[model samples]
Target: MSATRPPMTAVGADRLRDELEYLKRVKRPEIVAAVAEARAHGDLKENAEYHAAREMHGFNEGRINELEAALSNSEIIDTERLAVAPRIVFGAIVDLVDLDSEAEVTYQIVGDLEADIKKNLIAVSSPIARALIGKNEGDEFDFVAPNGTKTYEIKGVRYK
Candidate 1:
């Protein structure tokens, strides 16, 4: 069976590796210890602690499996190897100016797994990122937000 996984940048791959390591070395052991301690209390049916521990262990195992599969199938793209133009691309840090307010906002276009809106890291598949892709500086793009259509001008694009 062939499975297709989403592409990931080198930085995103590294972050996933770090998370997997933490889950394996720290979280897994902690959950095991908790389960063992809960089991020692004897009554299995009414053991709230045991049930909670089991639930946590289940979640941890599921996350581990997911991370493993993603990492295994990931096509790591190294930004340094790409001879891209001064336009939006995966792993590019883009600066945009709100046309209406004239306010500047910066976003790092990353893989889906690494996209954190709070950190201003947008996924390549996001609406804003999609509109920004292949756009050079001074190019204006419109976004269909929930409020209304908003336009933004590309101020800059950096590889770092």
Candidate 2:
């Protein structure tokens, strides 16, 4: 059987690379030092420092492995290489207005791995983003949010 992995956008790849660099350059050494210092403290059975350090080491190593695997298998898509259009696609920045509340919000449509709600980056698979797909300016779409169904009007779509 073959394994399938999610495609990562360029921004997601960069974030992953930054995390990997931090793990390798900073976290790994810090964990190693902590483990060594804990080991020097003596009695492994009752050494609180040793146990804590060991736990931290395990977590750090696990994360390192996971990041490495993701990076290795990642399919990075450059946003600049994508064709620009009115309809939503990966890397499209869309401006939306809430039809009910008349509130305005902008979101960048991105890959799953790079989705950050705080930054107004929505994953392509998200309900709102999914509804926005294939829609152009002046179009309206309804999304089922946790509270209830809400409608949004597409104000604009841009590549940048």
For candidate 2, lDDT tens digit of each residue in 86-152? 7777788899999999999999888776789999988888888878888888888888989999999
Return the TM-score for each candidate structure.
Answer: 0.93, 0.89
Candidate 1 ranges beyond 4 A from true positions:
1-5
Backbone collisions counted per model: 0, 0
Instruction: Tell me the spans in candidate 2 whose CA falls farther than 4 Å from its real position.
Output: 1-5
Per-candidate alpha-carbon RMSD to the true structure: 1.7, 1.9
True lDDT of residue 117, candidate 2: 99
TM-score of 1: 0.93
lDDT of 2: 0.85
For model 2, the run of ten residues with the poorest summed lDDT: 79-88
Q: Which candidate achieves the best lDDT against the true structure? A: 1
**Which ten-residue region of model 1 has the weakest summed lDDT?**
79-88
